[model samples]
Target: MSVRGFVPGVLATAAATACAYAVAALVPALNPTSVAVLLGALVTNVGLNRPFLRLGTQLAARHFLRVAVVLLGLQLSVPQLLHLGGLGLAVVVVTVGLTFTGTRLLGRWFGVPPARSLLIATGFSICGASAVAAMEPVADGDEQDTSTAIALVTLCGSLAIVALPLLRQPLGLDAASFGSWVGASVHDIGQTVATADRVPGALTAAVVVKLTRVILLAPMVAGVALVRRHRSPDTARARIRPPVPLFVAGFLLAVAIASLNAVSPATLSVAKDVQGTLLVAALFALGTGIHLPTLLRTGGRSLALALTSWVLIAGVAYAGVRLAGL
Candidate 1:
């Protein structure tokens, strides 16, 4: 429980994420940065760790990816938030609140195990794998639960990648507004761009709103962790502090990098590409590594929760988008 000896996992997470980045850079087909990262990370989860690397893999993934996300913020433009201003802030508050509450309440009602329920909720509400990683420790999500959360996020997020952009094309919405809609509704930042590109100006708005939402992680995690601690204070002698999750910090860093334009668009794009690959592999790992017996034992509950969460999320996301006139 001390987790003092878990250093190896940390190392592995970095190595895996890095390996993903390298692969993305090398692959010409993958232009978007998140795609590569998603693919590479997924590959690492399935191929690299299988039969040999599993020992510290999850630890590495859980711990190191946060730092990577911090490093990722090489792209954020703070001034943009000012440009979008009130609308951006509103989007963040509304989307996050809806997703978190819907998933939590619905999942609980459906009887999903607590960890799986939280994983589904957070992934749906925030930036997929990264958000799940950030929430994992606070919720005490074990390996399987973490994988499940990441898997669902990746699967759903990937679909959004292809669907959102195309979906917006027919809406007759302008670019900026489309971007905001995508960012507000879609799971990943990359997906937001793809979805918004079908329109004008929306891409930028989406990113701005998404980044602003990202900034709220500090408060959200801390508050959730605090509430969790109070709810289960008996067994836990000490409270779990869900400070700003490191990957979220890294994700912010990635945003900064993009914002400053310090890192070339090519480089940022490549990093995102790797992120995509990583996501694919993570999904595979999630599927393959599942403990069938355990899932069978708890799956009925999880399914119920997942369905309820989805209903709540869909209802809220739709309402919020409509309320914003998107």
Candidate 2:
């Protein structure tokens, strides 16, 4: 598509994202990312998403999200992950692996399609909407599948910001333990931060643990690509030649640069701001693709899968945290 074709949609998405930011600022409890998705959905369901805006929205949803994921790597530090210690690391790995595998199996049992299942599993297992976006090309899911997965993950993550903190005391978790659990269970980094921030001394652990899970995203995508290629060598070869997508490689490179402390704090801070804005905008674009009536009709099974996955992750992470004595 021509660059000009994307202008209208991109501009519309930008406007919506700005609105989302404004609303989030007014409502301190709300996340801009969540607000962006809602605004996009509202516009689409209300029939305001015009034909001329489609191309730009599509571009924003796909390319902009990928770029945001790349910038996300700057927030990770290798040494910080190492500081999680052996048992803490084990908790993260086991929780992610089990949640991912179990969610996929649950999707199959629910008769959900493979692509949507994979996207859901990825989103719930790794890092929410960003993970869903990253896995889209590898899974060969359509826009609907991507939007559904993003929606489910976003909802559950938002709920976590409230529910988990309330459970912290009942669960008998201290600040550090709560942080570990939040990091393990929450889908989005922002949600994790929100939940963990409710308890003093929890944010650092939550962020570090969440970033560790984010680190696993690249390998997970590559593994899925390899499995797909193995199952259908010819078709997969034609479509997905690289096991690791270029954007994923960029993510890794960004992580390495961050680890090396190559970028100055000022630059990193600016990159972080840009990353957040891009992600919010991309989510708004993705939201535009959601048809509320259609989503309501098809959401039953996906909602069940999402809820089940949410409980599974929380339970497993709780057990892991307790076992690890975090």
Best by TM-score: 2
C-alpha TM-score for every candidate: 0.70, 0.97
Show the lowest summed lDDT stretch of 10 residues, model 2. Answer: 236-245
Error of 2 at 133 (Å): 1.1
Error of 1 at 197 (Å): 3.5
lDDT of 1 by residue, 131-174 (tens): 67667767776777876666555556555656656755565555
lDDT of 1 at 24: 49
Query: Which parts of model 2 are misplaced by more than 4 Å?
Result: 236-240
Candidate 1's TM-score reads 0.70
Q: Model 1 Cα displacement at 143 (Å)?
A: 0.8
Candidate lDDT values, in order: 0.60, 0.91
Candidate 2 per-residue lDDT over residues 131-231, each given as its tens digit: 99889988887899999999889899998988999999999999988998999889988788878988899998898889998999988998988888778
What's the lDDT of the predicted structure labeled candidate 2?
0.91
